[model samples]
Target chain A: MMKNSLMRNVPENYNPYVSSDDYKSKKRVLIDKKATNSTVEYLESYSDLFDKLNITDGMTLSFHHHLRNGDFVFNAVCQEIKNRGLKNMKLAPSSIFPNNQCLVELIESGAVTDIYTDYANGPVAECISKGKLKGEFLMHTHGGRPMVIESGAIKIDVAILGVPTVDKKGNGTGKIGKSACGSLGYAESDVTYAKKVVFVTDNLVDTLDDYQLDGKYCDYVLKVDAIGDPNGIVSGTTKITKDPVGLKIARMTAKLLDEFGVIKDGVSMQTGAGGTSLAVAHYVKNIMQERGIKGSFASGGITGYFTDMLEEGLFEELYDVQCFDLKAVQSTLKNTTHHVMSGSRYANCFDDNVVDKLDFVILGATEIDTSFNVNVTTDSHGKIMGGSGGHSDTAHGANITVITTNLIKSHMPIIKESVTTVTTPGADVDVLVTERGIAINPLRTDLIEKVKDSKLPIVTIEKLLETAHEITGVPQKIERSKEAVGYVVYRDGTVIDTIYKID
Target chain B: MKRGTAGTLESNDAMIMVKESDGLKITITSIVYDFFHEQIENVIRETLKEEGLTNVEVICNDKGALDYTIKARLLTAISRMEEEK
Candidate 1:
């Protein structure tokens, strides 16, 4: 009886339902056969493809924004959805441009209930600022986007990719067509994970061999008359300001660079694409040209002006997260020196990233308070106007952060007793430059002493504040609400500051 | 130095000439290039086609005029012609 019980208690080595070694080998062989037979489908139009895909409510949709102000596809697609009375759709766009102003209408119509993107500019940011979306707007760095997709945090349902050129097999390229905008780096993550990937192109090729995006992953292809304007593709050349007042500030910033002793060989720096910041770049370029110095690298939103410096041998390399203009895109495509950086590699502070190596960074500000807190969001009227696009990240990472702005814009003083909202911490900002003078943060006394002998205009932070107040009688204190409208996230995704609704 | 009186046009095309101020004499010529080259010429011709044979020659000093700006200037000049009569 004991022997009979032991035989009954013996466990089976494997179940029939579970795949054994032989079953696994057979499954792999089947997958290989299917892969070889896989073929791409071509649809007559965008609408036809959408109908076939059956894009339903609560579906996750994505868009690429290589065309900044010139983009029309995002708005067009959203408008179509709005007409169809779709609701609760999640927009997981790589980025949103100012030209996609129609997104505001979609938000009003409740078609887009949630948004996840690396950056938002123009009216979409305005709507988000007004707390219009049903769900929270989750912001991610470029690298963070791919990471989230890989982790299945953001599973894409339908990715509507805007291609400059595409093949019949659904292969796509953005560098050669009439509206060529360059590398499809941002769309790489979506194509990998999306359940259905659609390529919308103006120029359709006969074959898939020349396309940069692999047709093996793409499922459907659609053709249109025009994708976007080539001129609008590179709307701004990322030029430096040549204005007198701007030049003075640029020169002062260069002097500060000299004083801080970060102007030597193998140093790295970053600057914004704004006119004044670009002016600082030009001045820095002049300094490098004169001293026979070379920088290790430059990083951030790469522009033509910065690309020119990289090509001119001022810097050994350019780590570009996103190309802002045609020149930048061309250089990134042709030149080996220009390296493409993923968003996570660019500024995700949670991860050990490349921004930590930055020696200096020049930024622009809308208002600066006496305590050195900088505000890039909200105007004097407390209206939500701007975004914290990589502002807090650069300020926190760089050893020296210089802010440039005129003392007054349109007869209104920019220096206030307290900023409307603090986008960058007071501790991070080292210097503030105005057309009239320069203000060194008191916390950075060492920088002040270093530049004491320089001919560049230097003044105390208090003095600059006083001067601004003297011109335009001190601004009345703004009353803020306790209810938060939006949150300013630091590079590490921490809540740096919260915005209240405009009263 | 060549001297000429510059005039402002009223809504009814009445000319109000003013004396020139002293400064560096500079003339700025503006050329409006459309995204499509033909659109610009078509716009200029369509707006000015209706006006009668004109004696007043307008030296367009363009700094960088948008499509609307070009149309407005041409219309204003045509309206000024009515005042001359």
Candidate 2:
């Protein structure tokens, strides 16, 4: 066994991100001069663990959303912390979900005074949008999250994570047991960097067949009855969108990708779990299967569709950071080609990231303007709905970034005078594919020149905006509020845009 | 007076609930209420006026449906509310 940066006795086959690239040159990561906790202390309860750690105010406690909307650890721990009347504790979860609605109470009670997450929505988001979160509610990208964590920008006092299965030595994996939500990718850095790390598990086995996280970092283990509801841990199954307008937008996006030679052999791609984005993958899959073209790797939050491709040999491998559905979780258990990459390895800026190897990525937009600035961070009314999970990271890394959406929905046009908030800049955005037409960013003249001769309904941004107005009619402009709820940070760690609270 | 219902809650489709009342009263719940609530109310007013319908209550449950879909649903609901039973 060889020692890694965290001084874990990594198995011979264990692969770590030894070096990182900054686009031009590769730099080596620092090695551990000292060792971390090599023994795991098994605790039975969160309160006991909290007391053992001396739970205090103004502590940055963290968790991961691998359990998605079904997670129980975050809520249970928050309730305990609230029960203890702890004040001013900062939540540093990787992302927040509806199940994490318990955070709303914590926020209101002043138990959780600050929040630092990559994406969020539902009650906690609504509370944050209403300007109820007393402390700074800052948003970061998935990649930027790890960068800041390692840089000690966001100091985490304790990282209490849920692990599905644990070995006697405290090594954990999210791939087995009842609440197996695969790919403990998001929690990897948390376990490695936090001052104290705890793994709460429901299933204890003699040994793990494979592991994503090392045991050296784990200082405590709390065995519980369950970590989360299995049914709610991940999606039942993801299906391609059958929405007519969505299909049209997706078809246009696929055609544009094909016309631009993005569907060729050895191509690497990324797509979200959105129906329209899935439709684009469906269309592109048919083309790849028809031509018998094999690709390299598909990365990011993987779905069953991409796993099917891996099985069919359409792609060589899948670099999954998080599993979006149950099928993906199963694939991680059985498929040898399915590999898990840490969040930093996935898209951290100033590091060699998977997105840098991405040829194209299909993403959605809550709103887009003629300038190609895309906003997934808020609704049309400027309420906090989502932040750049990997939107800007993939956009910045991919050779081509495509935004797919209907020109108008419910009489509201997507292409407007300007976006409600800028989650990704126009420089990174390459093409906008709507059912009405497709618009290429003028910055990407190379793409424009290539697709100019194609039969795709390529149009200028202004024409698309005009068509949107014709269908949706001119909408009344809502006044932007003076108070800012929060700010969106780009992948490069810059404040791309500030979100205004909806009055 | 009998009640009539038409349309659906699907995206780009609005559900219309119509019934007999003392005077025309239209209440709308639209996803785009912030931007197009006034427009949706105007569409209902114009459609009911053109149909020469009076003493009725119209409720529109909108899910980002377009103006034409809303109008069609309202018209169908009006006919249903007036049909012989």
- Highest lDDT among the candidates is held by which one? 2
Listed for each candidate, the true contacts retained, as a fraction, are 0.00, 0.81
lDDT of 1 by residue, A1-503 (tens): 01111011111321111110112232111011112115677777656766889988888998877766676677768877877788889998877777878888877778888887766767887777777777656655454465566456677888888888887767777656777776566676677667778888888878755555677778887778777777777645777787787888788778778877989999899998888888888888888999999999999878899888888999999987667788887886677887765555666544455677899999888888887888876665544666566676677778888898878653356787777766666777888889888888888878878877887778887888888666544444545565555544433333445556553
- Per-residue lDDT over B1-85 for candidate 2, one digit per residue giving the tens place of the 0 to 100 score: 7889999988889999999999989999989998888888988999999999888999999999888888999999988988937
Candidate 1 chain A lDDT trough over 10 residues, lowest sum = A1-10
| Model 2 clashing residue pairs (backbone) | A21-A352, A410-B64, B12-B65
The window of 10 residues in a row where model 2 chain B has the poorest summed lDDT is: B76-85
Which residue runs of candidate 1 sit more than 4 Å off their true CA positions? A1-41, A117-121, A127-132, A138-155, A166-173, A183-196, A204-219, A350-352, A442-449, A452-455, A480-483, B1-85
Model 2: which docking level applies? medium
Candidate 2 scores a chain A TM-score of: 0.93
lDDT of 1 at A194: 77
